[model samples]
Target: MSAVRGLEHVVTRLSDSCGQGHSGSLLEAPSADVLSCSMQAVVYYGVPGDITDVLPRIGEAGIAVWGPQDGEGRDMPHARGTVSYALTYHRDHGRYPDGSLMSTPVLEAAGMRVDWDRPGMPMPSRFEGFVHSCDPDGGHPVYERCSTAPKEPMSMAAARDQYGTVLTFSLGEPGSSAYQYFTVPRRQ
Candidate 1:
């Protein structure tokens, strides 16, 4: 599947004009104040995972932008959801399904900023991620160190290669074209 691209925006601050705090499902409170705040950090609402593919220096920077859609589902001028919050969620509290927190060093390398430790802010209960491999289908190759079935969600444990090189992780669906198109660059 070809990637569905959207415009990229750099959020520098979160606006609180609506007088709401970052608690509750971003999906439910469509009118949360966090949505209109400065783009500096992950505010409210979760977006589609494809933004990670276009964001700069990911795993080292910040969340990808998942632009908003119109009534007909066309890309709107503004973004509705963010992977930044999810990245911040992983940075502050996300644990694997087995109870282990992610330990990827590159995720904290710093290019994007997320105020993940707000004292009383609430976050999403679950997050989806995509793992990349050399295979165009994002599948784990037979006899290879790390692998996943094409388009199927895999555990972080299953995504890590024997060499300890993690491909790429995203909040998008594993089978998404944006996820599959993401390739882990070699060290060279």
Candidate 2:
């Protein structure tokens, strides 16, 4: 299937299965980028869909998609607890929003290497390891410790108000991807 067609198909499927309420946008990435020439589709299901069955179709489409890699130790057909599919798709496709990359430096400073191959810091699995500090000038080193073991994911606003940065990935239904990154913000 063509890239755009695949994206549209996926979005339609997600919208239909997830819920009646859904919204999405298609964005074009630079041709030089790894993403296909077609616009990258960003879809948000008001109620996240169960991808237990949809997972196989992603490979058939020959496109890269992403979402919460898995349900937080739960069975399939569960809503993602942390990261959004759009955020994951943007990072994988190198379409970064400003300040999103800030978390990398902060993670590195905390002695966590950014390695995707291993399951640890900098990876979504270890996202809860770091949180932002209100003191941005002092390098925002003051991190509020949250449970490393996945319990319930924190909301973006709650994380920002309390810790000044977010450090968690949603546990959502399965999808495809080329790469993925988190866009945690620091206090303004």
Candidate 3:
């Protein structure tokens, strides 16, 4: 809407740079070109769900950073199968099997950056995102509201069946630590 269109893409320039120096120092004066190119926003719809506990269970589910693993099943740092962050969601309600709730859903909807779960999977995600509640609430009229779950290779259901209520997450630069949102739990 015309109302929200007024504000958008607000970012400040960076003044520092990383470099090796002869003075035994790190981050020399930023090269003209280096400082010239501003840092592209590093944010997207980061679905940060909870893992009933936050450790072990998630350990079993490998993120396989770039893609699948090698024959030995070790993630090659420079290879496609490196390790990425593993996420889990839950409800503070009950347990599973008999289907009880666990933790909580922190984002409206989330997904992997790419779909590597398919046959002959193509290049991973170029960019992945979900609409912040503000985005849907007309935060920016020019921005389209992304109200949906992420796609294949990045889906939680296919990965691990976990769900919760009050999905919450941050908004922007000074974006808050956590904002709760919503989701359907498989608990009965």
Residue 168, model 1: Cα distance from true site in angstroms = 5.8
Winning candidate number (TM-score) = 1
Order by lDDT, highest first: 1, 3, 2
**Model 1 segments more than 4 A misplaced:** 1-56, 59-64, 67-81, 95-159, 163-188
Task: Estimate, for each residue in 1-188, the C-alpha lDDT of model 3 and write its tens digit.
Answer: 01111111111111111222122227663222211111112222221243233322222344222334457754333232122221221231323445654332221112222111111222233322222221222111222223332222233232222222111111321221211121122222
The digit string of per-residue lDDT tens for model 2 on 49-133 reads 3222233333244333232244453212322221233224334442345533322211011111111211123224222222211
**How should the candidates be ordered by TM-score, best one leading?**
1, 3, 2
Best by lDDT: 1
Residue 33, candidate 2: Cα error in Å is 19
| Model 3 residue 5 distance off true place after TM-score fit, in angstroms | 39
Please tell me which model should have the higher lDDT, number 1 or number 3. Answer: 1
lDDT for model 1 comes to 0.29
Q: By TM-score, how accurate is candidate 1? A: 0.19
C-alpha RMSD between model 1 and the true structure: 20.9
lDDT of 3: 0.24
lDDT of each: 0.29, 0.24, 0.24
